[model samples]
Target: MRTVVYLVIGVFFGIVLFKSEAASWFRIYEMFQFGSFHMYGIIGSAVGLGIVIVQFIKRYKVRSFFGDKIVILSKEKSFYRYMIGGIIFGLGWALAGACPGPMFVLLGAGYLPIVIVIIASILGTFLYGLFRDKLPH
Candidate 1:
């Protein structure tokens, strides 16, 4: 049942993204180019919904979907780290013409060059995991 729900959610998101013209690198690039608010609007809506949902969970003292208790971790407030991470992410996105999620889709669509980006992303993730504890907060 959980797996089915996951599959359904994944399919739903895939459909939404496909329909929104979000999977196109050119479209996404255009959003960044022309001061277009389309992408920003989509992201703002998502963030707004997420904030409301999280507030509802907090207000209701809700635990989890399966009745498990929730464990909330404190976020590190490090402006420098965030700036550095954003710069790296943006550079990769601009260079590859695909962010992480879209990279997989592009690869599946038979763009073989995305394999290198995927590998590099994986390595970066692994390295981050390895050194995260040592990084300054």
Candidate 2:
């Protein structure tokens, strides 16, 4: 089933995250403080890989698991929207000591305290869904 496939993929991804220290609070702290380049290197490599993957998808006309055509749409450019959103995201990351991507991984890796961050993330998402239409696009 697709659920099994997704679970396997998630396990592999979580192992990668743990091994790469992407889920480490210390690594995140270093990134925020500019104390080291380890996290930056990982993040930069991921970004570079993403660019290549996107190009490949576009060139080959990749399809989704459900067989739908994959579309990469560009959003309207907005400086202030990105600036404010980035500030809020950065503040949350700095405060919670982890990026949104690794919160669940942290919890799975025996970090019981990350439940708060996970809950807060879910709540924030719910709030966004409730207010997305009212907020600036």
Who wins the lDDT comparison? Answer: 2
Off by over 4 Å in 1: 108-112
TM-score of model 2 (CA atoms): 0.92
- Give the whole-model CA lDDT for all candidates, comma-separated: 0.80, 0.91
Residue range 30-82, candidate 2, lDDT tens digits: 89889999999998999999999999999999998879899998888989889
Which stretches of model 2 miss by more than 4 angstroms?
Answer: 64-68
Clashing pairs in 2: none
Q: How close to the true structure is residue 70 of candidate 1, measured as C-alpha lDDT?
A: 68
For candidate 1, lDDT tens digit of each residue in 81-134?
Answer: 999899999888877777887776766567798899999999999999999999
